[model samples]
Structures are given as C-alpha cells and as structure tokens.
Target: MNRLTLCAAALAATALGAPALARAEDGRWQIKLLGSGVLPDGRIDGVKTDLIGLPAGSRTRADDNVVPTMAIEFYATPNLSIETICCLTQHKVDGAGALAGARIVDHVLILPATLTLKYHVDAGPIRPYVGLGPSLFVIMGEKPGATAKALGASRVTMSNELGLVLQGGVDIPVGDGGLGINFDAKKYFVDTIARFTTTAGVKALETRHKLDPWVISGGVYFSF
Candidate 1:
C-alpha cells in the first residue's frame, strides 16, 4: 500500500485497540503522525530581470506538493498547550504572463518549522482548539530549469523566510485511551527573495515571491 493508505490503516488499528494505550492527563505530552497535502497560493512580484529575449514584465508562480508531516504537543494545563509542527515539502516554479510555458526553477525543497500556543475547549469527547505563532521557512536545494539555462542562468538560490501562522483544529477521542484523530488547518504569510546566476560575464536576476499557503492535515495522535 501507499504511505497514506498505510498510515490510515495503522491509525484505524490503533483506535480499535485504544484501551491498551496510555491516556492523556494534565501536564502530559502528545505526539502525532500525519499525512498532508500542501497547496500553495503563491504569487511572484517585483520580478526584475535582464534576460535578452524575455520580457521585462514576466511573472512567476509555484505548484503544490503532498508529503508526510509530524507534530508534538506539551499540555501545561488541561486547556492550554504548546505545539510544534514540521514538514519537508518540494515545489516547482513556473513562468507566467509574458514568460508563459517556461519552467523557471525545479525541485526546490522547503522546510517549515512552526511553534504555536494553543487553547483548547474542554468538551469531553470532542475538543476544539485555536493557535497563533511564528514559522521559520528554510529554502534550499534549488536547481535551475530549462528556461533558466536557455537564458544562460547557471545557479539559483532562495532566501530563508519568516512568517506568521494561524491555526485551528479539532480532536476526537477514540475508545478509552488518549488515542484519537486530529484535523487541522493552518494559514501562513511568507515572503522571500530568489536570486539566479548567469554566464561568467552576465548579470544575475533577483525576484521576490510571496507564499501565502493554506495547509490542511489530519492524523493520529497519541497522548501520555
């Protein structure tokens, strides 16, 4: 089976045998295993370039990715907690407007780490929570695509990003243990700069990209 299927099956089995797992109490720790699909609503702006044949008004955009994710939570009280979430995701950059049908950058990996302070409602078997925090986005492993090479571009790099994160979710208890399912949604406001190098005697291209992505995820949570 694929990774998503396997994860879902494992969660199902865990829930079926929840009586054997440890329960959640005050000041307890919870860890989660999640499979997520990341959809980015990104836009590229301030695209200043001097490539010979490309238009000065050319624009860019980014594509989505699906990956596995993880999170950890520490409950300071029955209704309050601190949580950290992380994921390693890959994205592709494409040309837009005047540079349509061209691939500007490929196989770029982004690592986003987020920490939030959450307040949960004590609603017996079902708990709802809201959180707000900061995220650190690390951009790396960027490779120049065909369009870049055709324009004599040799290397590409993206600057590290910092953003704000807003989150909301619900948790439902399974059986008698603290094993349950958590469904979450998060919004991020991130901005970064991309630099591209050209041939030995040519100047580089620098552009700004804004990534305001909404991340939705569901997973199995174990508390102790």
Candidate 2:
C-alpha cells in the first residue's frame, strides 16, 4: 500500500513541474543598450551666400558620427511588448575646397526619443522581433564659420522635428531566471526642415542626411 502511494505522489510532482516550465517559456521582459555609428549631411541652402559659399546653391558635408542608446521593454503578452529608447549624438559641417573654407562647422548635441510596439517570434532558444514607432528629435548647435554673434557659423539653437522609427532584433537565452544576450537594429526617417534666424530674417533650408544606420549591441534582460 505504501509503495502505491509513493508512486502516485511522484506522478503528481512531475505534472506540476511540467506546467511551470511551460509558463517560463512563454512570457518575459527585456532591456537593451545600443552602440551605433552614423553619418550626416551638413548642408544649408537659401541663406546669405556671402557668409559661406560653395556654388550658387550647394550642401555641406560632415564626418561620420558615433552614438550610444538605451531601451526598456515590458512583455504584455508572450509575443507582444512596448519599448522606448533615447540616444545622444554629435554633428559637424565643413568647407569643401575654396567655397566655405576648412573649419569645424558645428558642434552640438542631438537627442532622439522613440516609442514602439513590438511582436516577437519564438524560434527555439533564440527569439526574433520587429517593431514600428514614432520619434521626436531636437538639434542644438551651429554652422562652421560665421561672424554673427548668436551662432556665428558655429551653432544653431533649435529645431522642431517629426520622424518615424523602425526596429528589428533577436534575443538568446543564457541561464535561468531570465538572463540573456540581446541584439537589435533601428532606422530614423527624418529630414532637416529648419529655419535659421539672423539679423537678416528667417530663412528655410533643407539638409540632406542618411536615414538608416546599422546597430549591433548586447545587454541584459530580466523576466517578471
């Protein structure tokens, strides 16, 4: 009789453990840190040509840039979640030949923040995900060489920006209790539609730029 009771208890334990293991495989929370390299086009048209001139109407170029970002996510369901990310980056513009001449055109800080809705696909220990969202950007700095006191060809204060962000990535599980490695990519669809204010007046200019930048990074994720 005792042997039969022991066998029944063993069966019940296995049943309970199986369901708990299944739940752990279902839902989770994640976080990521991004290291990115970017390139910018620093050109302004429709302004006073006497300040800096390349051709009649030409654009300026800047060097490649590097930036860092961070994000947090909550898994509302096993395959769905919401996320937000923030980044800091710098930009510059310079003279091309006898035109504007050589100088560190601008030095400023750029902050782009975004919110996204994500969907994940289960593929063994590795899961892949994709998302879409909107973003807000603020650019503060100046151009390379102007005598005007405000920016004087060295800075521009502000820009009101509207943009879109698209993202995709994967996660790999490492150990127990929701520890893993994460990877993701993001793109910002934006344009420079800003007006510079000087003693002359407000002038509208369009700055050409790159839209998609590659991001390869790793961080930690915790499950609740």
Candidate 3:
C-alpha cells in the first residue's frame, strides 16, 4: 500500500479502537502538527508580456509538495474558534500543453500564512468543522530552471499576494486527555505574476498565473 493509504488505515484503526467522545470540546487552546500535501494549478491565466516567445496554447504547471505544518487555535466558545497555520512548501514550475516537458522554474519556495474562523459540529464522536479565512502567499525564493536559462532568463520571481481559504476537517478524539487526530483540507484561491528577468535585471517576460492549491493535512492535536 502507498504511504497515504497506510496513514488512512492507521487513523481509521485508531479511531475505531478509541472510546467515543462524550463531552463537547471546550478547550481554550489547541495545537496541531501535521504532514501536508500541497497540490497546485499553476496555469497561465494571461500573458502580459513575453519576450521569450512562448508557443501558442502553452501552459504551466506547478508540482505537488509535501511539508510539515503547525497550527495554533483559540476557542472563543464551545462551537467557535479561531485558528492559524504555518508551513513552507516548495514546488517546480514546468511548461505544459504546447511546451510540455520543459522545466521553466525550480525550487520555488512558498510560505502560506493563513488564519481562519472555524465552527465545529456536535457530532457524537467525530467532531466535524468548517472554516473560512484569508491567506497570504509569500514567495521566499525562486531559481530559473534549465529551460528558462536557455531562454536568457537570468532571474525569476513570483509576486506575493493575498488570497482566500475554504477549509473543512474532522477531529477524532483519541483519548479523554485532550488528544485527538485531525484531518484537514483547505482550498486556496490565489494568483501571482511571474517575472523573468535578464542578466541586466530587466524584465524579460511577465505572466499572470493561477496558483490555486488544495492543501490537505493529517495530524495529531492536543488541547489545553
């Protein structure tokens, strides 16, 4: 079985073996440590300017990444909470469609700063929740790939922008001592401008891209 399948199986077995949650979650604070998967759609929305002469119907795709994530939450009420997460994910941008198999950018680092307001449902054992929030995609660093260097791109940069996040998750209580297993999913709607600069620090190309990503995570939580 794959690693993800193993993780899901282990989580299921643990949940079934544990006693059902009998009390409402009213902890004033909670924290989660998770392993997350970031899957992005880095398609070119529009080409503002292209000095590299991109082919017709050319598209770009960002590779998926796995990273460690941490979240801190404050419970304002029994059913309401405020939460935020921290993580840095890395991806590679590659050409698709007409320019398939071409690597355009490499080692792009993204730090997703996110905050959400969550509402928990009063399920019998599994605590289900939904949340919405704002996020900022901070592009820390980017390097030009082989293809970009061949096209005379000496530098690469992606704009940092604000976005929205829609979230959903379930918390399965593992024990009575404020411990649980959390599986969360967040959808991000964001975009950015990718600039390819020449050796003289002049912009050679600029393209608007859609960076919508679905971040899925699984982890253990502790309430205090």
| Candidate 3 per-residue lDDT over residues 115-214, each given as its tens digit | 7889999998898999998888888579999999988899999999999999999999887999999999999999999999999988889999999999
The global C-alpha lDDT for each of the candidates, from Candidate 1 onward, is: 0.79, 0.56, 0.84
Best by lDDT: 3
Predicted candidate 1, C-alpha RMSD: 6.9
- Model 2 accuracy (lDDT, Cα): 0.56
Model 3 scores what on Cα lDDT? 0.84
lDDT string for model 2 (1-224, tens) is: 34234323433332333333334346554656556665554445334324333355344556667665566666667788777666656666565544454443456555565677789898887899999887776665544344223343322444547788788888887887677777777776765543334545543232444323333445655555
Off by over 4 Å in 2: 1-28, 41-57, 95-104, 141-155, 197-216
**How many residue-pair clashes does candidate 1 contain?**
0
Count clashes in each candidate, considering only residues at least 3 apart in sequence or on different chains.
0, 11, 0
- Candidate 1 lDDT at 5 equals 52
lDDT of 2 at 47: 47
lDDT tens string, model 1, 86-170?
A: 7777898898888789888976877777778899998878999999988888787899889888877888888898899999999
Each model's TM-score, in the order given?
Answer: 0.84, 0.67, 0.87
Residue 188 displacement in candidate 3 (angstroms): 0.3
Q: What value does the lDDT take at residue 158 in candidate 3?
A: 93
Model 3: per-residue Cα lDDT at residue 40 = 96
RMSD of 3: 8.6
